[model samples]
Target: MIYDVYTALPTTSVKEVLGTFEKNKIGGVPVVDGKGILVGMVTDGDIVRFLSLQEKVYFTFSMAYVGETEPIEKVLKQRMNTPISEIMVKKNLKTLSTDDTMESALSLLSKHHFKKLPVVNGVGRVVGIISRGDVINRLAKMTSDSLTIS
Candidate 1:
């Protein structure tokens, strides 16, 4: 588990979330409230899905015209100000506790196809984050150590 977890707030802007992801080289973050309670989650996939463009068309008896669409850059710029809460996954969040074992973490990650899971405390405060890579690395290290001659 990564103790130094990066997180976002519900009110955080989409632009800020993108910046966090870029700076930290992460694909997703758990959204927390003011008191650091896990509320939702946001990911690159969510942003991509939310920003998918739908082309509109207008037709008349004598002519057909495609509705004008803004460039992606412009569209992104316009959407940057939107709050992450608008796109965050608010329901059905799966989380882990500090006492959860590595096996449990791996099971949840694989079962739900989650890249990461937030570790929360008794009161629902985020304590850390566990990722698939973290678990795999730990397992590899353990296996190697067990195989090595003392």
Candidate 2:
């Protein structure tokens, strides 16, 4: 579990979220409220899905033209100011508690194919983050220690 977790606020702008992703070299972050309670999650996939260009088709006399409603640059600039809350996954989010064991975290990550899970306290405030990599590393260390000759 990573105690030093990167997080975003509900009102954080899409541009800011992207900056955080780039700066920290991370793929996703848990969105927290002002009180530090987990509200949602924002991921690179979510932003890409939200920013996908919409196809526009125009039909003329015996002709058709297919194009995007707006230019990609225009869409990007416009969406940069949008709040993360608009695109964050707010419903049916999976999370972990501090009391959860490594087996539980690994089970959740592998079963659901999640890269990371937010660890929260009794009040739902984010305390840390556990990723698949973290679990795998710990397991490897334990195995190596067990195999080591005295």
Instruction: Output the number of the TM-score-best candidate.
Output: 2
Residue 22 of model 2: what lDDT? Answer: 97
Worst 10 residues of 2 by lDDT: 141-150
Cα lDDT of candidate 1 equals 0.92
lDDT of 1 by residue, 1-150 (tens): 899989999889999998999999999999999999999999999998877665668899999888866678877877889999999999999999999999999999999999999999999999999999999999999999889676
Please give the CA lDDT of all the candidate structures: 0.92, 0.93
Model 1, stretches more than 4 Å misplaced? Answer: 57-70, 148-150
Question: How far in Å is the alpha carbon of 91 misplaced in model 2?
Answer: 0.9
Q: Which 10 consecutive residues of model 1 have the lowest summed lDDT? A: 48-57
